[model samples]
Target: MENQQNDVKYEEEYIKNSRGVELFTCRWVPLNTEPKALIFLCHGYGMECSITMKGCAGRLVKAGYEVHGIDCEGHGKSSGLLGLISNFDN
Candidate 1:
């Protein structure tokens, strides 16, 4: 398994969703070439993707795939309250 940090590019950013909540997102991409595929990851409840998924993302990136992850609203570095909310019930 490839795990060289230099073989991949990592990035993090925050984006505001339609509800105006800021969400944390991160991505890992292979350097110098197009990725073989794209993979999106969603962390489980009470989990965040950045630190928890770093190793997994790195390996995928070095293997020629692009990986992306996001912190759901209220989880990780995102804004809002913890636990689930029924936003669609309004």
Candidate 2:
């Protein structure tokens, strides 16, 4: 889905990872100009990208950067046992 906040555009999607788990991903991009750079956001443990890091993403977008984030396996909207990392290989 897509939405606009001020001059930034926000979008979210779900994609299956290599392990076949559906992961939630989101991005914020400057709507009126080419982004200066790309920023990949990494949320803390037990934190999800959309809600937890939204403000940070917005700030970056306003600074002329595109920000992307993801809810890792077993966290947030991702499909897996909550709080379980198992292994990082996947």
Candidate 3:
């Protein structure tokens, strides 16, 4: 577990959609190793990906997979009204 934690690499960033709302994003990957696969995770409504998805993401990274997560609009550090999804199509 300690070795896995030391080998894990994580990053957080933000991206804007067409509507210019910033969405919080994160990535977890193993250091000095090529990922075997990629997994994208979306947190539940009213939850932030950073908090809700960290455990799973860490495990995946430790297993040599790249894990990514994004906080939808209105959640986490994303720009929008809390607990609201402005558009289902977005």
Candidate 4:
């Protein structure tokens, strides 16, 4: 995990119509001072990526790994409401 004090910065956003609904997303790009090795990320539940996740992204950026993530539609900030919606559907 990348630690604080690293000037690494990342982008945050959402992915739309991914399978079903929009996906709240985030991106962490390495400094690009050197070639990146890999990428790491996690999908959200039903909301836009928040500061908490941003910190995580920053860390990944500092680690020299491209980071990408998505907030699961109808879960994160994509669209829809809470589990109640799913319950009703079921």
For each candidate in turn, the TM-score is: 0.86, 0.94, 0.88, 0.59
Which sections of candidate 4 miss by over 4 Å? 1-9, 18-20, 43-48, 84-90
Q: For model 1, where is the 10-residue window of minimal lDDT? A: 1-10
Candidate 2 structure, TM-score to reference = 0.94
* Pairwise TM-score winner, candidates 2 and 4: 2
- What is the number of backbone collisions in each predicted candidate, taken in the order shown? 0, 0, 0, 12
Model 1, runs deviating above 4 Å? 1-4, 87-90
Q: Write the per-residue lDDT of candidate 1 for residues 32-69, one digit (tens) a residue.
A: 88999999999998889899998888888878899999
Global Cα lDDT for candidate 1: 0.85
lDDT of 2 by residue, 1-90 (tens): 999979988999999988788999999989999999999999888878999999889888888999999998888888899889777784
Q: Which candidate leads in lDDT?
A: 2
Clashing residue pairs in candidate 2 are none
- Return the TM-score for candidate 4, rounded to 2 decimals: 0.59
What C-alpha lDDT do the candidate models reach, one value each?
A: 0.85, 0.91, 0.85, 0.57
RMSD of 4: 5.6
Off by over 4 Å in 3: 1-5
Instruction: List candidate 2 segments past 4 Å from native.
Output: 88-90
**Per-residue lDDT for 90 in model 3?**
59
